[model samples]
Target: MPTPGFPPHTLDDEGSPIWLDELAAEDPNHTLHVVRGLDPAAALEVLGAKPQWFQACELPDARPDEWTSLPGAALGAEPGSSATLLAGRVGEWTFVYDDFGATDHDSTEALSADGRAAATSMFSINADASLTYAVDGKQLAWINVDDLDLAEDLPGMPAELRAAFTAAGVVEFDYLEPGDPDYAIAMRAACALAGLACTLDDLRRIPLLVTPLG
Candidate 1:
């Protein structure tokens, strides 16, 4: 059995979803652990952090662990000034923002809530790996982890990764966009296939970036 942690193979020899493997290779410092069974507020407290460049905003209805912010005065006229970035908990997962200036400096508009979800690292990494094919919160079909072997014929799958899974006798799962009653089922199945304790319900509540505690 694979150990439940980082360094790729630590999780299992069956191997994690190919995308997850690549993600770990890119940023081994953070491990993606499932978040489950915690109160939303408590989860936020543990997960939320104030974003570095923005001035904080205090909303009347904001939860205790929530941090809402507009571009700070120092950002002055830069794209950050026009944006409102939020970092906090929504439902069961911790919502976080990556550095926008570092990656998306050309944009002229504020980040909308759906944009926030899309901009979040969780969605980005998954999309990059073809784990969940989505953009700006709109999910398209995803590679089925349970049906990887069949996925070799997928139109856009990365060939090297496809060969890797195929060589390993892995079966990739192919799923449609969420909204079908089976979306949750797919998430649950993926988690189990990946040796994760986190549930589909946890994922449905919010898309979150997983960070290693230590």
Candidate 2:
């Protein structure tokens, strides 16, 4: 089993969290950039997992094997040629992204507090928010005000936040990174949609995994 050991990713200049807005500014010709963060199963390809699959992150609706290669685009660019790899660690989880392949990309976006995955188990939340957690997927776990014991699988959050969650009835809460699976992701999507922008201090962000709930 993959151990949870990824770390918080940061930017070189401002020391802020690595984000998409920065990645999108890579080139002038590259007007559209699509990214998505895959789950453990999806990440196996990069972690020495064999037999690969490809797709254009921008065209999720497109055929699975099809990719619209754009000239001067990073994906189509030569290997190691100005290829920007953004990433971080959160235990055994290594979250990363390059504007290259489609499936390895973190394109699953948030309707609000917009987000995507840079790599496995590490999701990037563009906005601040709250979340709910449950051990049963078929059942719905409402956002409660109690603290949750999330040491086993939920290894990303800080000890302080975990304590808060335990007291607040929250079993899940992280600064939703860009790589987390969409299943049970972004609980307050509507909140992000209602308001154009909300500061990190204003709302609650949570990273909920449905697998454990199931």
Candidate 3:
């Protein structure tokens, strides 16, 4: 069995953790971006947040309902705009979580500039999920977690990446049972590959800093 914080073992005989499933059920739509080599503050800045406007908050406090409930003026965002994120550092990587928001390709490329790397894992209410990895300012690979074939022919795909995909069971996503924790497993495995040891507990208890999405 792979270690708890590592791939394969992350989801054991019990399947995906209840918290992860509950989070997806509650939020339905969210995106998580992990940036290597940047602390939480610098990662938020790279994503276009002003230093003075930063808000210290927990991950739960940044949930869509909680955030949207606050007046736009309070968040320094346009009224009714769903453009906020909760970010924090886990080991050497900064994890940014956004509700109903996504970091575009340009932003990921920018975040990964100068020998750094970044990855985004997006989940939607419709059971759709995707992950993208970028390194040194270029998108290295992208894959729809539900469909591995979509990425089988990616040109210039690196061997290490393919290995990561394989180790994560992303390459065999099609074989998972209907109710398996495929999304969580694949996403966590990819994060592990980048040296991030994110767990459901981390997501729930981490001291996340908040800012409006850039």
State TM-scores per candidate. 0.22, 0.23, 0.67
lDDT per residue, candidate 3, 126-190, as tens digits? 86777788899999887776665424443345675655554554222456654334655546545
How many backbone collisions does model 2 have? 47
Instruction: Give the alpha-carbon lDDT of every model.
Output: 0.28, 0.25, 0.59
Per-residue lDDT of candidate 1, residues 51-114 (tens digit)? 2333333322211211211211112223322322223344433322222212231111112123
Candidate 3 lowest-lDDT run of ten:
65-74
Which residues of candidate 2, in runs, are more than 4 Å off? 1-16, 25-50, 53-72, 77-91, 96-214
| Runs off by more than 4 Å, candidate 3 | 1-25, 59-81, 150-160, 170-181, 194-200, 203-206
lDDT value, residue 78 of candidate 2: 43
Write out the backbone clash pairs for model 1: 144-172, 144-173, 144-174, 145-173, 146-171, 147-171, 147-172, 147-173, 148-171, 148-172
Between candidates 1 and 2, the lDDT winner:
1
Model 2, span 1-214: residue lDDT tens = 0111112232212222223223333321111111133343343333332323232222111212222222113234443244233222233332333333322212222200123222111122222222332111111122221232244424554342233222322112254233332211222121111120222212113221111000
